[model samples]
Target: TQVTCRNSLKNPLWSLIEIPIISSVTCQTVTGLIFFQNDFCARILLLELKWCVLCLLLNEAELQQRSPPSMISLAGGSPNPNTFPFLSASIQVKNGRTVTFDEATMKRALQYSASNGIPELVTWMKNLQKNLHNPPTASYSPEKGQMDMCVTTGSQEGLCKVFEMLVNPGDNVLLDAPTYSGTLTALRPLGCNLINVPSDQHGMIPAALKKVLSRWDPSEVHKPDSTAPKILYTIPNGGNPTGASMTAERKKEVYELARLYDMLIIEDDPYYFLQFEKVQRWLTSSVSVPFPWAPTFLSMDVDGRIIRTDSFSKILSSGLRIGFVTGPKPLVDRVVLHIQASTMHTSSFTQLMVSQLLHSWGQEGFLQHIDRVIEFYRKQRDAMLSSADKWLKDVAEWHSPSAGMFLWMKLRGVADTQQLIVEKALEKEVLLVPGGVFMINSSDPCPYVRAAFSLSTPEQIDEAFKRLSLLIKDAL
Candidate 1:
C-alpha cells in the first residue's frame, strides 16, 4: 500500500531523513516523502539540490497524436473556431518583439497578470454575469470568504483540483448518470466510488437524487457515512450527451434538495453560453433556465454549497485551455493551494490574450458575440433535428435539445453501440459517440448514441445522419 499527502517536515534534526518502517518498508525524502507498506521497489540518494523546469507546448499535431482517435474525429461539443472569421482576427500576432506590434490590444497583452486573473477580465466577467442574471450589485471577490474566482488550465483541471481538495479515498461522490466522461476519468484514479443518479428529458431528476441519498447506508462496509455527499456534480445547462437543460423551476427544486442535504453543487456550465436557439429564445423572451446565469448557484446560495465551473473552450478556442471557478472562498482557497503547489497558475500568456480580447469587446460586445454563436448553433441544431425526424423517427428517438450541440438518440433494439460503430459506422466515415462511453460503468449496454451538429456544417449534417441511419439499419 502507498500513502501520500501534502509535504511537511517530520523531524528538524536532519537535513534529510530515511526511516525504515518495518522489515523492508521505508519512508524517505527531503523535499517530500513517500511511505510504503511493502518492500521498497527502488531507492535513490541525491547529495546536491538540483532544480529543473519542464514545459509541454502542444500544437495541433501533438494534440491529435495525444488525444484519443475517437475524440479527434468526432464533431465534438466544442465550437469549430476555424468556422468563425472574427476569432481569427483576434488571434493574430505580428511580433512579440515590441509592445506596439498591432498598436491596440496587442500592446496590453504583453504585460504580466494580476494574481486572480487580469483585473479587467475579472471585471468583464463580473459585468457579464450581472447582465445574465438580475442579481444585486453583482460584485464578488477572489479575496474574503464568500466569493472568489481562479483561472485554470481548463474545467478538467478545475475538477481535478476540486477532487483533490474534497475527496478522500473511499468517499462516495454523487454524479449524474451519463454525465461528463472527463469528470469520471479524472476522479476514478482518486479511488472514489461514483454513485450515478438517473436523469430524464429534463436533466437530473431531483426526486431520484433524494431517493438515492436517502437510501445510502453509512454503516455498511465501504460506504460513506450520513454526513452528506462529498459533492453533487451537475451540468444543468446542456448536459453532456443528453443535451437536457434544467428549467428554472427545476433549478429551484434541485437547489432546495442540495441545501437540505448539505451537498456542494458543482455547476459545470462549459456549454452555458451555447444553448440551442429555442432555449435562447425562451430565455431571452419569457422562459428562463432553472439556474440563474452568471453568479448562478453562488447567487441563490445561502450556505455556500454552490460552486460553478465555467469554460472558454465551447465558445472560444480550446487550445487556449482557459477556464474559471467561482464559489465560497474556503473551497476556492483550498483549490488555490492545490494550484500553487501544482500549476503555479494557469497559462499567463493565454490569460493575457483572453483578458485583452474581453476588454476590447466589453460586456455588450461579448453578449452580442454569445448571441451570434447561439444563433449559428441554433440553425445547425434545427437542421439536424429535421433530418433525424425524417430519417430516424421510425427507428430511433430523441428529445430536441434545449441548449448545446448534441442530439442524443436512444436507438430502438440496438445493443453494443460501441461495437456497431467500430465495425460498421467508421467504414462509412460517419462518427458519433456510443452512449455507453458516457456511463460511469462502461460494461453495460446503453442503446443510445450522441450526434453532434456543433462542429459539422449544415450542408454536411444531413448526409452524415443519412449515412448513420443506414449503419443503424445494417447493425439491426
Candidate 2:
C-alpha cells in the first residue's frame, strides 16, 4: 500500500551533452508488475493494461498536489443567504482590513473570573437569563447556591460535564429519539443506560413521556431511576434532525412535568438566535420582549431545574468554540469541578472577542446581525424547497423548517435512504447525509435524508438535486 515516486537527477542539458540528443521517446506500453507472497517462492505476474496510439505527452514534469476545491457543501446543517442577504454591509469589506481584538476588554473579561463565570459576563448572561426565564432575578439574589453561569467550549461540552457529574455508571438517562447525535456520542463512554422518548413536530410528546415515565420501575433491568430521570435533553429551537421548535405552551407543560418529576432539563439551543419565523423576529423586537432573548424553558422555570446551554457559534464564528451554561449554583458548582479538571476554562481571548463584538454592535446591532444570518438561511431554504418542488415534489416530501439550516426530506416510497446515499448518490458525486447517522439507534431504518443549503450556489444546488433525483429514480 505504498506509493513511490522516482525523480531523475541529471538535467536535460547535461543529458543531451553526455549522450545523443533525442527529440522525443515514445512509450509503446507502460507495464505495472505485481508480486504476491504465497506458498511458493513469491509468485510474480504482469498486470493487465492498454496503451493508446503514439502521441507526445508531457512527462517528468513538476506536479504539485493541491487541496480539494472548496465544495458545494450542501450536507452539514447550515443556512443559505442567497434568499435573504441581511449582512449586505459586513460581507463587502475592503482589502487590507485586519480584525482586531480588544485588549482592555480581554483583561476585564478574565480577572480570575467567578467560579461560575467572569462577573461581568455572568451579569450579562444573567440579564439574558432574566430575558428568557421570568423568575424573580432577586431570588437568584446576591448569594443563592445557584451557579449563575459557567462558560464552556460549547453546549456540547457543558452537556458532557453535566452528564459526568450527574450520572454514575449504569444510571438511566432519557433522550429524545433522533436526538442530537453529539449527545449520544459523548455519553456513550460514560456507560449510562439511555432511554429514547418518541416525539413529533411539537417535540417530545407529553403523552409519550408520561407513558414512559409511568412504566418505569427502579428494580427493573432497564429502568432509568427510582425517583425520576437525572436529565431530560431537548433542542427546543431548530432541533438537529427534526427541525422542531417547542411552543411556549409546550414549554410550560414540559416545565411542569420536570418540576413534578424532579428532573433537570438540558436546553441545548445554539440556534436560538436563528429563529426563522418572521413573526418571532417581530416578537423579539416588541417592547414586551423578556429575558434569555426569547421564551425558553429557563424563562418559564418557577423552579430552577433548567440547565440552559447557549452558544455563539451560530451567531459568531464556529472557530471561536465559545458557549455558556446557566443553572442553579449547586449544580453548576459540581460541573465546574469537572471543568476545573478537564479544560480549566474556555479561552479568555475567545470570550473577550465575543464580548467586544457585542459591545461594538450593541443590542440593536447584534439583532441586526442575527436577522442577516436568518435571512440568508431563509433564502437558502426557499431555493432548496423550490428546487425540490420542481424536481422532487412527488419523489420526496419535507416539512418547511421554522428555524435552522436543514431540510429533512423523506424520500417517498424509499425505505432506506442510507443505502441510496452511500451506495448510489455518493457514487454519482452527489453527497447527502442519510437519516440513520442522526439516530440514537443505528439499526432503525429512516426513510429520510438531510440536505443543507448553507454553502452551495443556486446552479450547484440545481445540479446536486438533479443528480439526487436521478439516483432516487434509479433506486425505484
Reference-based TM-score of each model: 0.72, 0.72
Taking the tens digit of each residue's C-alpha lDDT, what string does model 2 give over 1-476? 22122221321100010111122223343332211111000100000001111122211110101213553433223233233323212221123332353444434333333334444555666665555455542265322323367788877788888776655556567777767778889888977778888876767777777777776542332122243465788888777887777777777877777655556688888878777775432224455332223478876665556777888887777888878887765456556656755676676556655665565665665666776788888888889888888889879987787777777888988997988898888789988889887787776888988888778987788889999888888888
Q: Candidate 1 residues 1-476, lDDT tens each?
A: 23232222432211222332231112222232222111110111111011111112122322343468676433223244344333122355332222122433333344323335555566667555545653321343322234556777888788888777666556678888888888888889977789988897788888888798886443332222333464788888788989987776767877887655546688888888886533232234554443323235555765556677888998778998988877655456556656655765676567767776676666555666777778788888999999998788877989998888888898887976888776678889988889988998898988989999888887688888888888788777
lDDT of 2 at 273: 77
Model number with the top lDDT: 1
What's the CA RMSD of model 1 in angstroms?
Answer: 13.1
User: How many clashes does each candidate structure show, in the order listed?
Assistant: 3, 17
Give the Cα lDDT of each candidate. 0.64, 0.62
Off by over 4 Å in 2: 1-116, 136-138, 141-147, 217-228, 279-294
Error of 2 at 433 (Å): 1.3
